[model samples]
Target: MSTPDTLAFRFFSLHVVRTRRLGPSLVRVTFAGDDLAHFHSGGRDQSLSLFIPAEGRTEPGVPVEEGENWWQAWREQPDGVRAVMRSYTLRALRREPDEIDIDFVLHGVGPDAAVPAGPASRWAARAKAGDRVQLIGPAVTDNRAIRFRPPEGTDLVLMWGDETALPALLACVEALPAGTPVRAWVEVSDAGDVQQVSTPADAEVTWLVRDESCAEGSPMALGAIKQAELPPAAKPYVWIAGESGCVKTLRRHFVGERGIERRQVTFVGYWRRGLTEEQLRELPED
Candidate 1:
């Protein structure tokens, strides 16, 4: 079970069946499992935790039968043998054949450069068919992790994200109702990181290409947002995800500067600069 309220989070064994490069920094990994038929994902920006083994190890050593104690057992494992877990968004989910697609950002070479590769990016870069990993995800739709909740009667949507949050932002954009108005700002490492996204919403996307110096947390996007002219809408739903510091800054801009009600926006720090997810997760709640 997950924290606060158990929301059908379960452990499942998944294997890589195919891999492809979507753009300069994005690698799409498709996974299939026998238990996928039992899995239910509420598609828009749905996320799950993946346990990837360290170098030279093939299987992720995470408990599959511990239920509510699953995470505790995994955390208690020897650091050397424990799999490095990371959270990622679902790019695509096909129910017919029990398959799911996750797009990972390659920060070192393909789409990102001037830095070293992280565990997840390294795995995606070298991953091949038959590579297996453990996952703790949902078997039902109403999980606590799905945060793209736009309230009823929303008139427009405003979104902001960086490379790490691109997949989730794009997924949410594509799933919006037809004729809905959406204004999105997506920041990537470079022009090569840009990809075409199809959506039925009256969507307007402004891609912010970043130079190496500002690849992680630059104020470029926020600067652009300040100068942007948003379409007319009163009940605007806003979603922001990416580096923690940037997410917080953007949240303040929306609420304090733009005068949008703080409650109208849903923001998440998918990761943080100069810190690992584990460190970010350990931060005490305010």
Candidate 2:
């Protein structure tokens, strides 16, 4: 009998067919699987969970099967199951009968990027064409009211992020409207972390380097943002992601103190400064 907690959603097994270094800190892993054939597209900025097989496991990782017992199965994984799961955004979901590409940001050793190194980074570093990893989620948000789309009539779009948010920033750039004005401020450890991103829109991109002395929450990006002046009433949308505290401060300056409408900005706490993903998940929403 299927467990009561088992979900009715379709699950798929995918293999990492390719890996590419788009930038010093960004790695794109392309996955192909029969399971992705039914994946629903249209989630421009949605998040997904990647289930990586624990080191040395040969068989593909399994998803919690459907039914009431599904929840039980999740709660009762065999001790030492060789699987590591990490949350990442769906950079692009192009469907070609049995293939999908998911890009992950390779957040290397950083005090601010506290999430433990997992299969995603490991696979990106050494995954060959035949290696496989299971994909677990496109976690659907129930409130359809909260959808994401590049704002229209936008004269300028300002995007800023630390390494933890590189994937989303790339995805945003790729989805931008042609000829739309945009600017990106990316903060990285050093010049080695730079990556190339293609955008249909015109953009002035800047990279901020932390040359071994700056702290995680330094105001480098924020300082750049403050100095930048936009076209009058250009309907600019500000997207910022990174350390929770830093993001919150930026949010206040843009939306609260600066009088920008709430809908004109998107702020995400990709990961907290000192908490693991597991712990961050349990934190209360602000």
Candidate 3:
């Protein structure tokens, strides 16, 4: 049974309603459930902990508990019986049907792919309707997981993301007010992964394809951003997410090189290049 994880967050039992291939490297999965009626979000880069069934199981095995001890209980579960947890961003939410969309990056999914796909990628690639999953998500709007906050008096918005962060980046862009000045860059595995972004803001977006220029494990956007001639702004807010190392590099460039205040730049490492989320969580923070 689902329980409250925190004051602002609770567990929701959901099942896949449908799946659609957005591109060669992206798939959108829509989930619906009665429990979603209470689910709410501010929705820019709202993060959620999604638990899918382990291999050969139909439903995820998670411990039921009250308060924060649920984390320890879950960690103590047997590896094979334990649910596979992954972090994801909410792409779209619909009120009429109480459905939410999560865009999954189908990294290294095919036979000819250069790298091997992870458990979440494999699960998403073959996901079908009625696949049960669980999520720890927001129960109220303006929760802490949504990280794309621009402080008051932000005259310019700058953004960068890789394929993994593309969904969140697009959502943030679309949410910006009309006439807002923005410059954004997104990097993806291939040109086929480029998306059509509809935003009311005066935004300039650049798409960088890894297949064309960047080798795996290399930072693609840093060089382009280094040469960019951004419009003058008294105050700028920068949001960057993607590969951890790349994100750090960009953060340093903005704060150290461009003289932007550290507080004005928001950076998140959506994923590390060589580490899984579980492995990443085990390491000490910098």
Candidate 4:
């Protein structure tokens, strides 16, 4: 494997090597490639954009070009031949043999309580060894999308995430300095969807399982937030993700109702209520 420069984004071709069923709604796909030895992930909440070939397709045609506007070149490809591109968090990375893991939430229920076999979900749920894909990610350790920065003097860490952000949030907890104080509220679809997360910090995690009667986004989510008695901290660093509208509502509540400063919170809208990832990308940031 060739080592790329320390400050660059590059495409690496990887192949599925294993798969695991983590819970009722989560599937983990592990991939490996010789080139992954060059991949640099900053650990917590690090994200990668994967170009996955449609099922039964073998090759993921990543352009040989490297440098500025690589995305423009990718966009110019014909729709029929283009791969499905989506952003996902790196669940784990191992370099001894060059491997990485990605956890996909199997959402979009079908009639009769079935799981929808969408592009990414289908691939992950049925992924087999030798399945190939292209990953565009940091070749360096300090990429800009690694949104775990908390300002100095921060004494507490507060996090709220739906299933989509669970891997990232857990990664953060796994790496936090021992004895740091942390509080997290994670929402999932059902009791079976709850995942075990451990941290060395003085940590408290509350899991909220959504039932069929629960409305999408902020209605029930806001009610749950209001009902919890939050730990008091002089300086709390709040991180929120999941549904776009829900994230926006929580952002306002933290700053307006909770009396926290706008700068003290870090938030990202991972997805929306009714839009696909591509459609969500086209919208202005909330």
Pitting candidate 2 against candidate 3, the one with the higher lDDT is 3
TM-score of 1: 0.93
* Per-residue lDDT over 132-186 for candidate 3, one digit per residue giving the tens place of the 0 to 100 score: 9989999999887889999999999999999889989999999999999999999
Which pairs in model 2 have colliding backbones? 3-67, 3-68, 3-69, 4-68, 4-69, 5-68, 6-67, 54-82
Tens-digit per-residue lDDT, 161-196, candidate 2: 777776677777778778878888888865877777
Model 2, total clashes:
8
Q: What is the C-alpha RMSD of each candidate to the true structure, in Å?
A: 2.1, 4.3, 2.3, 3.4
Q: Pick the candidate with the highest lDDT.
A: 3
Q: Tens-digit lDDT track for model 1 on 1-286?
A: 2432345777778899999988778889999999787778785888888889977788887776676676788788887678988899888889778898889888775453667888888999989999998877788987777999888999999999998899999999999999999999999876877889799999999999876565546589889999988877779889999988889999999999998989999998888787877887798865
Alpha-carbon error at 180 in model 1, in Å? 0.5
TM-score of each: 0.93, 0.81, 0.95, 0.91
> Candidate 1 vs candidate 4: which has greater TM-score?
1
Q: Give the TM-score of candidate 4.
A: 0.91
RMSD of 3: 2.3
Which residue pairs clash in candidate 3? none
Ranking by TM-score: 3, 1, 4, 2
Range of the 10 consecutive residues with the lowest summed lDDT in candidate 1: 1-10
